[model samples]
Target: MAKDYMPPSDFLRALIDEDVEIEADDTATIKRLLSFFKDPDAANRDWAVFLLGQSEVDTKAVRDALIGALNDEDDSVRAEALVALAQRDGDLARPHVLEALSAEGVYPTVFEAAALCAHPDLIKPLRGWLKATGDKEVDQMVAEAVAACEASAK
Candidate 1:
């Protein structure tokens, strides 16, 4: 079954416009911006979620939207959501970001999110992954994430 996608609303385009006035915390702006997550353009949806993640609107609506974005078909969008969630609520976002590690093709992004959150609980598992993967680049990422977690714990 095909899902019909609506075009981005004028309000949404204006809200996202560089020249148009942007009030990051405006309730209406936030709502309109959040709605772009359903745009037919995957890139649009991904970037919409990315910006929302970066936005200061930490309302439950925004948070829920970002969490939902963790499952977006676009890996980049999902990565942004994971990072944003981790930054917003480290303890809550920890397990999920760690889970992304097990998926294929999203290693670097997930690792970056895990590092940003610096959740101590992730250290052991990251270390385990390090030993198992044996890829020098990934090991570096894992080591950095572990260090970040350890530092945050201190």
Candidate 2:
């Protein structure tokens, strides 16, 4: 959008792609990515959170960064943080997800994180939303969240 808005995720895929070799240290990459969570563009923040969630780094700085993203002004960024936490650390993500889900108008994005975390608490809400929202895309995500939570219970 802007002349200088190079997304923090542009070079990150190279590190995550497996096929692409990382030319720099992983921590540097992660730290750079962490800064994206605060970027002006919501898309950049969302993309950074998504990629960060997929990463396998276990450093404290990374963990703190993801946790900090829950406070983001953009809903999508907050949602992406939840998904990332779910992917990278489900146990750590539960309370935050529950807190976020307690509010209304947080669907679809929240569902993505809940689906990944697979917490049984999400099943009822997901099911209710599945029946309520006629939007196909949202229905799919709700159904997936239900299935994921149901599957985890077993």
Candidate 3:
């Protein structure tokens, strides 16, 4: 049987609770939560990183941390980091996201990263994929991304 696990810090408990509270004002809460990223406990650090991705507040420190997580030893962490970075700065992350998508034996995480980027420049690469491979899923994602970009531009 698996034992029930408890979060170690009051700050973390509050953070997790806040993640589920749609009515909670994200700006103030996310600012407070960002500090936990440097907590002494690895669990706290990881949790902070994960939550930072979900937060609406944008900051240079959060961006740097998420980018650093891209190279983390843990694949799940790396994947989440990529997602956070893409969400935060699709324009800045475009080159890295494209490289990940185009690499041999591309992982689903890489595709997911590209999907989250939703950058206009991605339309070209995604269109090229559609032309070269005729993969319906990739084509559909690219189409959606293009549509989203168009919508945002309007």
Worst 10 residues of 1 by lDDT: 1-10
lDDT of 3 by residue, 26-134 (tens): 6555656666555556566556666677766567766877777666655555656676787878776778877765655344445556766766666566555543435
lDDT values of the candidates?
0.72, 0.74, 0.62
TM per candidate comes to 0.75, 0.76, 0.55
Off by over 4 Å in 3: 1-14, 19-46, 104-109, 120-154
Error of 3 at 96 (Å): 1.7
**By descending lDDT, how would the candidates be arranged?**
2, 1, 3
* lDDT, model 2, position 119: 79
Point out the higher-scoring one by lDDT: 1 or 3.
1
Residue pairs in candidate 1 whose N, alpha carbon or C atoms collide under 3 angstroms: none
TM-score of predicted structure 1: 0.75
Error of 2 at 38 (Å): 2.3
| Candidate 3 root-mean-square deviation in Å | 6.1
Quick one: how many clashes does candidate 2 have? 0
